[model samples]
Target: SAGRPMTAINSSYYAATAYRSDRMPNQPPSAERSWIRRFAKFRLPWGLTQEVALDDFLIRRKPSSLRFQEEMNKEREEKQKLGTYIPAPYEHVNFHDRHDHESFRFSLWSKRSHFWIYLTGGGRGLFYIAFVVSMMTYFLMLFALDDPWLTTTVELLPILATWIFLPLFCWALGALVIRYLPHLWVKPSRGPIWEINRRTGLVTLFDYDNNGEYKKNGTIGELTAPFYEFDAYIATIPDRQGLVTNVLYIAHRYRDIVINFRPLFAPGEGQLCCALWDFLQNYMDTSRPLPDLPRYEQYRHLDPTTAEYDRKTRRNPRFWIDMNDATFEQELYAMRGKIDQIDTFQRPNLMARHVEYVD
Candidate 1:
């Protein structure tokens, strides 16, 4: 069912939550754990899909909901005064979710239009299951033809060809649909840079070239627009049988941004995706008005982590403020300094594969 149509879970989940910071302050840690449970009870957010439910939860928890809204207000005001959407060259958004004194294990970033969402967990299970089903279907087709197993090369040729070409066509069609359905449809695929510019009232995307320059500096293959256009949607990329593997980002243009939210369809993926959306929607207040920079400025507070992170990275304060192509390269070089190695994390508890050949 991955190849099925993009089930509309929320026609405007991201858009609707943009300015609703008032409700975000009082939520406790336990509230996040039970959000899915609560949603199931109410069937809320409308257009519920299994994928959306999982992702929305994770995304919502990544940034301190309190801090995220606070920063959103700051950036919104800054954009209004400048009349441009350029990011604060020095502003760094860092979060360290730590316990037992291990310090921050994750380095998820989102400041103004910049974001580094952790979308690397879950989805392989569904894909492996889908692969198994494809194999099962192939065998069934062969058996229905009254064909013996590997009995003759001549007869086997047609069966093998059919098995191969059929899935190939399905995969191709799925890719085509995901790639070309532009202007308020799915984005082309996922890359590095993402931005929702309140200043210009547009969402911009940049290709992830290895330049290591400031996140994005007028790069090639740019995708930008107010994606609330007709035909803009959130759809999935499918395997041969059209089961969802990734949710392609769709807006006014086919931004090549496909999120692999269904690698095995683990519940964890949905969480990460949801968290990403939460960070993104902060910048995507479509009805946001200009001005009020002073109001946002007042909310800015001195963060304790700033000094510690600076020392950890061993960089100067002004170094970040004067970000450019060359400085980005230098910072990457500095990060290569050796650190203690962590234990290898095992993943993939199960797999799907064809029968192994015997000697």
Candidate 2:
């Protein structure tokens, strides 16, 4: 009875159970049958000769059914022997969740410490330069005077005064400016340098918007802008070993403070500049084990006598300043020249990369 087709049954149970009461409603055709009819127009050849009932098709009485059962049993036995079915290939462990917190803490400490060191170095450099120039000027004055007593007196007084008083005055002034000038302290016009975390990669410039506060022109009846805001990235970079390398400096000119003077060196500019100065101090201290990946390494092994590698190998990695416009080109050039002279002893390469005028 289990193997018999229900189409031949006469009982009410059979009628009630029919797929469609009017036309075998309770029993629908299998997907295989539907697929065969749908693509029958293609005239594809069939491997089996006869249409078989579902019950008989799955039983071992039929040759195809017996073969299918044997294959299935073999597969079952193999899987059982293997303990459990496992798909090919294994998953990799995600290390981010495990080490993220530690990495973040270390990065934060490094950035803070580095920034402090950088500021100290910059401040010392500034003081040293001022001292050197003052001393040089004093000597020149002595030579020009051609009077032994006056020259000696003038030289000694300024040297003693500078050594004892000038540094204190400058330090006090710097502290006062940093504290009282909150607006100027964080302002973008100060050539604000920013350092993003070491893991984030390069910081990119975003939109710049100008604040409405402006100075007015008397005759032209025009309003002068007072502040500019830039939306920029705070990003970090990684080293070859997947470790945080250094923070990146990103400049975004979101807004401009248009004043009577050239917008470039206006008062608001101090904020940006100071911010940059602050950031540079931090960056120099934090960024370490400078990326020394050999440039043009691919061509190094091509020939024993390749001139490109030979030249590059002898030269050290260089750092260059990139400027936006020609307006600041002269200032940046002078700074680069000064840096070159200072770094002459170390022989570290320094240069500038200037961008073209945009508007």
Candidate 3:
């Protein structure tokens, strides 16, 4: 079993400390937010501060010879044939591509912002292109059929609605895609930057690709939370059997917007999540308990791999939109505030005594 066990400490996570720990605990928790106390006693109880600044990172690794890789590949093939390869839910190291061995930075905001995972202009293009192609294919097939199964497939003036309005539909979809894109996208190597302002506990996201310079409008996302909200949503990863595996998702969240791109966007399993979680563990309340990982269950709540997670989002270019529109924004905030705080959060810390790389 080559699975990377969940370690108590990951040094790689702590290697990029933006501020000293001694100075951080002493700073006034959230000084910039004093303007709100004047109006009412509505304070977000999640002790936030402004002492720390998330700046940069380092990914350390050791290379292996080509012969070693060949040997490993052969071993992997044999395991596959024998059905004994049990893959770890997430592996931070990309052994095949060497991508796991790189460093990147977090993007920040001009004001209160929370964690952000950006889809670049190029990434957006790929998204729209794939979406448009799939949609076009489906619609074309529908028209060719003698009749569609769905009741909404009515012919409301076929020449005007179906033929003429088809272009309009495509235009609208394309516009939506463009709206979600940053002006440019950074190379995957540089990655997107994420900042959690100590002052407000809010997360700010910066794109190193299109907005690396941190222009006035460089920020792609800003989300706020009141106190603490807790829940376990299912993250789906495909399996060899063609079905998907359901795992408990633990990452940054604010109401409907959840940011855990570790399994998808980050190189390897997601080193940043490990690092960020480790950092937060020091500041966050520990009396509360975190959600348990699953034993055996199918995911039923949200599916991040779909188009609806984007299209159905409130604003076209908005960051961290809800998985579903049924929940009201205010209700979400209230629900989060009412729920007990939990830090299912985990980050790699080298000092954790495990001799493991802090994520």
Candidate 4:
């Protein structure tokens, strides 16, 4: 059942794998073909990799893992030296405590909406094309017309209005009408699509079917599982062109629910996804402080664990929000380099004690 107590889960058949390691076992591409139909066209980052069984790896949450701890410590020291670090500007696509101060909701809805808009060719693509064509037509008219500059500009106005402005206006008007019409009649999402509630230790996923016509149905669309019941996996799915895409996903041990993690981290390489998995574990574990990322610095005081951790360590609350943009960007570059050098496979699987295995 959904949202069952974590203690009720006694075992799993999958072997736990280190989150940082990209070494995946070779398995059949067709292992997940049944469910793959729904996500066949998901435009995730692609690279070459060996195809593996979808369920082959169970990535455990290991906040205490040595490499995770070391990298976090390094980040802390570097940021402190860079001056008071300020949290980056808030974005709708990532984690936020807006729903509940003690909880963090991770969202991909904005990105999903954008994807649909662009897929239909009615987003920036339409506006950009309209602007470019209008400019070219204006220049062409100036060269061909015999009138003086002002007269030519005046004469071109009607032509531009008929050939460009009116059509562009119609397209923009249609897009807004289409986008806003549903909201006028249909109810919006009942809750955030993905959320990790630190106070309750529950992870929620509001799953929506493929159709973009309607919002998620009531209780049938919701799935809430204990954070401990979730395991991360880096799925190496090959597309029709034979290019493999490495994407991160979180799945319930005993439920049919799976959350696509690509929109959050937007990992281009498999290793970045591993790092994000490490950070996510740290974020969810109430026993530990929040991962010292620029994004979470502002919310440190809201989470009990993080507040206490900051107090004990005498951490500056505005560690990220106060830094200059130039310095922050430099540190980001340095951090990326450090992340690339991280040894993902060296740490032993720390979920050994928490997860029971069945023969």
Best by TM-score: 4
TM-score of each: 0.24, 0.20, 0.24, 0.53
Query: In terms of lDDT, which candidate is strongest?
Result: 4
Lowest summed lDDT window (length 10), candidate 1:
348-357
Query: What are the per-residue Cα lDDT tens digits for candidate 1 across 1-359?
Result: 00122122232323332322222222211112133322322110111112112222223332334355668878988987989766643344233221111011122233311211111111233344555665776667667766566654455556556655555555554445434532223222333344444333344445455364435673446555442220112233355775554332333312333222233234322233332232233323222211111112222122122223334456444333234546544443432221111111121101011111110
- Ranking according to lDDT, highest score first: 4, 1, 3, 2
| Prediction 2 TM-score vs. true | 0.20
Model 4 CA lDDT for position 343: 48
lDDT per residue (tens digit) for residues 123-167 in model 4: 346556767787788888788877787898887777666665544
C-alpha RMSD (angstroms) for model 1? 21.9
What does each candidate score in C-alpha RMSD? 21.9, 33.7, 19.7, 13.2
Q: Please estimate how well model 4 matches the true structure, expressed as its whole-model Cα lDDT.
A: 0.52
Native-referenced Cα lDDT, model 1: 0.32
Q: Which stretches of candidate 2 lie over 4 Å from their true place?
A: 1-122, 149-152, 159-164, 168-359
What's the TM for model 4?
Answer: 0.53
Candidate 1 TM-score versus the reference: 0.24
lDDT of 3 by residue, 1-359 (tens): 01111222223322233222222232212222233322321111122221121112110110122234447778878998999976542244222121111112243231211111222233445555655665675577567776753532444334334443444455554455445532222112322444433223233344333434434555444443321332122344565666644333333222333444343233222223332343343223112111111100011022111122223433232121212333334434543332223222322222222112111
lDDT of 2: 0.30
